[model samples]
Target: SGDLRIEMRDLAVFGEESERAARAVFAAGKQDEYWDYHNALFEGGEHRPKSQLDDDSLVSLGEDLGLDPMQFKQDMNSTEAHEQFDTVASEGQSIGVSSTPAFIIGGKPLLGAQPTQQFTDAVDEALARAES
Candidate 1:
């Protein structure tokens, strides 16, 4: 909806592997391929096991997404990418978030997975508040 804008923040509460993956995503954003990489990583959902998201897998995903392999790899391992991931993770922590799939609408925390209706209701409420 034009009235709503969604911003995704990565919180690596899952562990080091998740942190690395998050860093890779942030790095991908620099090349204007964040969504492509993100979608590719989670395309099959549960069918795509966590074990397959290692450093090598991340680079391969970048390559598959048409990103430059060498540049993508360098960016993924860069200090800037690590810093960006840490910054976002810290922002989530400051808001009492400690897990993935968390949503915040109009500064209200909607922790964990929710039904479609819950998101719709939150969006409606937020839009109403914004309009007022």
Candidate 2:
């Protein structure tokens, strides 16, 4: 096994519907299908011409994932889910994350599309710091 751990955070900056997507994904997380929903959104984002981040589309996505349709909508529209999205977005902004696909390795940020070797170097440096 490896010591590497990966965590995803919400930073809604893509479009008008991004905040809606964030809340929907948060709701999915509550049902323990966070990564599945997250991955589906990302994959869909790449191919879909029109934005699928609306409430109806979000609920449909949950239904496809076997989540309760009504419950998913309820959770997605709940005040708590919105607050959670706001909190994470605020936290990311406080830490200087302002864009999609940003990475923070060892407390140092790597912003925007980067090469694989760059990530390798960053991880190696992070591991070195941890070991030292």
TM-score of every prediction relative to native: 0.86, 0.88
16-116: candidate 2 lDDT, tens digit per residue: 58888888889998899988988887785573334577889989998999888888999999999988988988888888999978998988889999999
- Give the whole-model CA lDDT for all candidates, comma-separated: 0.84, 0.86
Model 2 scores worst on lDDT over the 10 consecutive residues at 44-53
Per-residue alpha-carbon lDDT of candidate 1 for residues 80-117, written as tens digits (9 for 90 to 100) = 98888879988898887887678998888899899999
lDDT of 1 at 38: 80
Clashes of 1: 0
Query: For this target, which candidate reaches the highest lDDT against the unseen true structure?
Result: 2
Error of 2 at 10 (Å): 2.2
Q: TM-score for model 2?
A: 0.88
Best by TM-score: 2
